[model samples]
Target: MLTMPDVRAPRLLCVEVHEGRPLSFLTETAAAHLAALAARSVFVPTTTRTRKQYRRIHLPGPPAPYAICANGGHLLVDGESDRDWQGAVARRLAEQCAPLAEVLAHLERTAHPDWTRKLRTAEELFAYVVTERALVPELWLKELSDWAGQRGWSLSAQGSKVYLVPRPLTKSAAVAEVVRRAGTEVVLTAGDSLLDADLLLAGDHGWRPGHGELADQGWTAPQVTALGERGVLAGELILAELLRRV
Candidate 1:
């Protein structure tokens, strides 16, 4: 839990829109905890965000040595994507899942423009559709999920975005690479979405907020602690707990 719930909050703005408007903020306490955690450990920001999108957030801490972006399709080392890693991921996706073009064409044929706001391809690895959550039919979503599943892809709807990602493109895979390079045995992680489920499971210890797709599904595991806090408060608690453990 590392961000403020209210955009209007006076907390330290950590993420911003392309136009420079505040998108996410971190409380001073959370910021301090994150900074401390970074000082002691290899703090990696693992996310489903594309490399460009991940760069928008200025998290409070020394810059992380590695970041897993595009759901592990790209690994950033010192703010630049590792080309060798990208090539490996590309090969994996080519072997494991249906091509991105096929998925994109299916969406174009099936998705209704009335509900779909935009269809985007991230890192040319996966596709997502921005939709009005309420307007999206459950049956359509289920069907889409089934279709993706059959093709070695998975669908997750978080907030207003529905992601159709290749099953092999996972954050945990990239994190393992980082761990190997860092030569660390103990791994800790935190996340609050379906995309993050694998990462949480891979960690020796992990945490999830009371909100997001995983929380909504009541997902949990023995090594993962499920917190009751929501929003940015949850982010603060996660960082605090991580700081304590490290």
Candidate 2:
């Protein structure tokens, strides 16, 4: 929600690939609005990215005091993973879901190499398949989703990565921990994917852009606004609306 999806956009790029590929862009207005929000609010970045991947983007603001990474498998406090939180997550996953090894083996058996580029495990907490998005069959995805759901897991496809994550590990769970520590009551959130559903629901108010899995699925709730704006413009609008509500 914070960066442009298109790499070739003329807008100023604030997020880049480690190899300097300019993977994502952010407009100046969005940057300014984000800075303003950071000055007044907690401004935690909740993302599905791993810690290493999340660190690659440099947004305009003071570094966030806390961040939720790896879809809530890892919680970072001032850039360091909290061991206690990690241990708790590990315990929950062990008890509530099929083992990661089982999930990885299933992917290896099912994923077609013609479309699947790589199968990866992130933070040893979840598995994902990197595939050619267009070539990935919808029927195959449905089968995989169904298979995962039966095993106390879930699937989400964002961009080229198809994530297989345990149902117990969620951004909202991590956010609740943060809220408990910070003693905050009101929560505002913005996201565009099915994976973000829990976080959006946990928030007192939320927003989702007009494009993404949530948009395609026509997902919304009483407190969440489905914005018409998309791409980097949607990012700016989200920050502006967050500031207004704050």
The residue pairs found clashing in candidate 2 are none
Q: Candidate 1 on 43-93: residue-level lDDT in tens?
A: 999999988888998887799999999999989999999999999999999
Tens-digit lDDT track of model 2 for 163-183: 999999999999999999888
Provide C-alpha RMSD values for all models, in order. Answer: 2.4, 2.7
Per-residue error for 6 in candidate 2, Å, reads: 13
Question: Once superposed on the true structure, which residue ranges of model 2 sit more than 4 Å away at CA?
Answer: 1-10
> What are the lDDT scores of the predictions, listed in order?
0.91, 0.91
Q: Name the TM-score of candidate 1.
A: 0.95
